[model samples]
Target: MECTCDYILKTQPDWEEHYENCKVKWIAREKRDYPKNNDGTLRLRNKHLLKLDYDVLYHLGLDTKTHDLQAMFGDVKFVCMGGTKYRMKETAKHMANILDIQCDFKNIVKQGHRYALYKVGPVLCLSHGMGVPSMTIALEEILKLLHYAKAKDPIILRLGTSGGIGVTPGAVVISSSALNDTLEMCYKLAILGEEKKFPCNFDKRLNQELLSVADSEDFETHLGVTLCANDFYRGEARTDGAFCDYTEADKQTYLQKLLQLGVKNMEMEATAFAHFTSAAGVRAADVCVTLLDRLLGDQVTPEKEVLTEWQKRPAKIVGNYILKYYNK
Candidate 1:
C-alpha cells in the first residue's frame, strides 16, 4: 500500500497540488505533536518532507491565469440576478442552453442562485445573480477566484436588474459611479462617524470600454449615479403608506431631494462591492437593466419574471459591451 505522501504524489502532478498536499501533511504532522517552521516548510519530525518543495497544488491545475479564465467563463459561469433559488437554477440552465455553454444546475448555493464560467475568446466571463445576496455572493466568489488565479487587474462588469429611480423603466444605465449609503452601518457600529465615507473607484479603462460597447450597440446608455442601500424597501422607502417614520409629505419631499441629487437607480449590492473591492484596489463598475420604475410607483414584486424579454434589450447591450471590452 502506498503511503499518504506517495498517494498525494500519484494523484497530483502539479505545484499547487503538491503545495496543498504538503500543507495538509504539515498540518497533520503538527497535530501529531511535531515541530514545524513558521511558514510550514521545514519540519522537525522529518527533514525528508522538506525536499518535497515543489507545489503540486499550483501545478495540479493549470497556471493561475488559466484557472481564473476557466472559472470566470468556463462552461459554468454566467448566472442570473434576483429570483427564487429554483428559478435561478432553471434560468441558469436555460441561459447555458441559449449561450451554448456547458452548465451544472445542481450546484445551487446561498440565496438560490446558480453559477457558470463561460469561455469566450481569450477571456473568461464570471457571472451570477438572482437576488441581492446571491448576486453579491457570486461577485465575491468571482473576486476570490481571480485572486487565487493571480489575475492582474482584471475588470469586472456587473449585468443585473435594478429599479429605475428617476429614469424610465427598461432603460439601460452604465453606472459610472456606485454610491453606497449603507456605510451608515459602520457609523451605527461606532467604528466611524456618519460623515466618514468610503467609496470605491471604478476602472477608467474598463468604464471607457463599456461606453464604447454601448455606443456600438446603439443602446441608450446613461452614465449616472446609483445608490446602494442595505434594505430594498425601506432604503428606497417604497413601502406602502408609512414607508418610514416620515409623513406622506415628507416622503414626497425626500423623493424630490433624491432626484435632485441625480440618483438614476437603486440597488442593494453595488455599494458593498465598491467598498470592499475598492479597498482591495480592484477596478469594478456596475451596469444594470432597469426593471421597475420606482418613481412611477411600480413595485418589483416576486410575481415578475426574473428576466423579461423587454429586459433583454438592456441585458444584450450590457452583455455585448462586456464581451467587447474583455475581448479587447
Candidate 2:
C-alpha cells in the first residue's frame, strides 16, 4: 500500500506525468507523523492535504500558498475567541495595550465577511459567533491558518459569557471539563450520519495557570465543569422560551442537580471547542463570565452597563495570563 512514486520521482526526470496517476499511497494510515512541528507547533493529520498545491482558508480569506501565513501569524501565541464581533475587537484592543503594541488594528478577516479576526501582537483575538456550529467553522479555518503559520504551541482560549450555577453574576468560570445538557462528559458529534463521542475536556495545567493568574486579579474565579447546551432556551431548561413544557420548579430542580454536580456555568460551545483543539494537539481553555446566576433566575436581567463590565472579566483574567507568559 506504500508509494512506489518516491523512487520513480527521485530516479526519473519524466516521472511527473505518471505521478498524478500513481496508484501508490504515499502516506501510512496506521502511523501518523508526531502531529507537531520541530519547534512543538501543531500539525494536522489529513494525508490528502500533503498533495494539495494550495489550501484556501475560505472563511479567514487566506491561504497557504497565496498568503504568507508564517510571516503574518508566526509570532502568534494565543488564539482567543469569543461570541461577538464587538467583544473580540475590544479584546484585541485590550490585548494590544497589554502587549504594548501601538498601531491601528483592522479586521484581518473582513474579506471573508463571516468572522472578525484581529492580530494583537502575538495574540489572535477573534469572534466565533454563537454556539458550536458557528465556532466549528471558525475553528477549522483558524487551526489550519495557524498550522500554516507554524505558530508554536498556540494557547487557544474561548473567552465568552455564560450563565452561572451557584455563583453570582459577574463571577468568572474556568472550565475544568465540558459536559452536554444530558450530563454526558463527551461531545456527541455526527459524522457521515453516524454519531460518535469524544472526551470533552480542556488543559488541566492551563486551567490552574489561569486560576493562578485570577488570584492576582480582582475577580471571582471558579473552576468547574461547563454544561454546553444546544439551545438558548429549551436546551438549557429555560422556561421563557417561545415553547417550553418544563415548569419553573422542574427547571430549578435540574439546575440544583447541576450545581451539586460542580457545574459552575452553562455555555454553548466548550464541548466541541475543547475537542477540536485537543485533537489538533493544542492546549486550550474556556473562561467565561457569568451574565446571571441560573440558580437565581433564567433571564440575564443585569443592566447594560453592568453586563458590559461583567463581559470583560474573562478578558481581564486571560490578559493577565498572557502578560505572565510574556514576562516569564
Candidate 3:
C-alpha cells in the first residue's frame, strides 16, 4: 500500500489511478468537520456538493480527488481576473512583490490553452479571456474550485481595461453596479429554454475601499455604473466596426444616453462576472482603467509605455486593498 503522500496525480494515467486510490480519504473528509464561517455558512450555491466523493476542474486540469484542495487553495483570499493571459501573469508577479512574498510562481495549468492561472500566497490571478461567455465558463469552474477548496469568504475582482464615457483616459473606475446592453441591472441567461435574470450588484464597501485607496493616489478614480456589452462594436455603440449601419452621430447619441444614465465606462464581461459572484454570495468588484475616452475617439491610441502603466493602475489599487485588509 502506497502512502497518501506519494499519491499526487500529475498525468492522465496517474490521474485515474489517484482517483481510485483517494476514494477512502475523500469519503472520510465528508464525515469530518467541514470548514465554515463563524455563523456556519458556505458561500457556494451548490449546497449539496459535499455529497460527492470527488470532483474535477477540467479546464484547470485539477481534481479535488487527486490534489489536496485544502492544502493547495485553502489560503486563497483574493481572486483577480483580467482579459489577457500576459496581463494576468504580470499581475500575479506584481502582487507577489507588493505583498512582500517571494514566490517563483509558475503557471499551474499544465496545458496553457484554456486560461492562465498563478497562485501567489493568498491571491489567485487568472485570465478570463473576453466577453460574457468566456467569463461565464471560467466562473463556473472557479466557483466549484473554491467550494471544493473550502476557501473562506474570498473576494473576487475583475481588473481590466475599458472605454471611458465622460471620464478621461487613464482614469480608474470602480463599478457601482453592472448593467447589460438593455440598460438593465440584470444578467440574462438562457437556461432550460427560458431566459433567467440574475441581479448584477457589486459590493459597495469594496468599491469604497478601492475609492479610498484611489483618493490617496494622484491619479483619478470614480465610482460609477459600468455598461457591459456583449460585443465591442454594435453592442457598445461603436462606429469603427467592419460594418456599421449607425453613423458617427448615432454613436454619439447612444453614448450620450449611457452617460446620462450614469455609465462611466464600457466593457465586455462584467454582466456575468458580477452576477455569478453575487449569486454565490461572494463579493465581487470590477475595477477598470479607461483606455480611451469614447467621446473623443473610437480607437485606443495611447503609447505603449503609457498603456502599460495605465493597465497596472487597477491591479495596484487592488493589491493595496488586500494588503490593508491583512495588515489591519
Q: Which of the numbered candidates is closest to the native, going by highest lDDT?
A: 2
Give the candidate number with the greatest TM-score: 2
Assess each prediction's global lDDT (C-alpha) against the native: 0.49, 0.83, 0.80
lDDT of 2 by residue, 1-328 (tens): 4332212112233223222112232133213344565565676767788889999988878888778999999998899999999999999999989889974779998999899999988999899999999999999888888888889768788999999998978999999899997899999988999999988777655676677779876779999999999999999989888999978889998998998888999999999998888677677899999998888888988899998899888999889888877776
- lDDT computed for candidate 1: 0.49
User: Each candidate's TM vs. the true structure?
Assistant: 0.59, 0.89, 0.86
Q: Tell me how many clashing residue pairs each candidate has.
A: 37, 0, 0
Question: Which digits, one per residue and each the tens of the lDDT, describe model 1 over residues 197-217?
Answer: 554445434455556557765
lDDT of 2 at 307: 89
lDDT of model 1 at position 97: 46
| Regions of candidate 3 where Cα sits further than 4 Å from its true position | 1-44, 47-53
In Å, residue 246's CA in model 1 sits off its true spot by 2.9
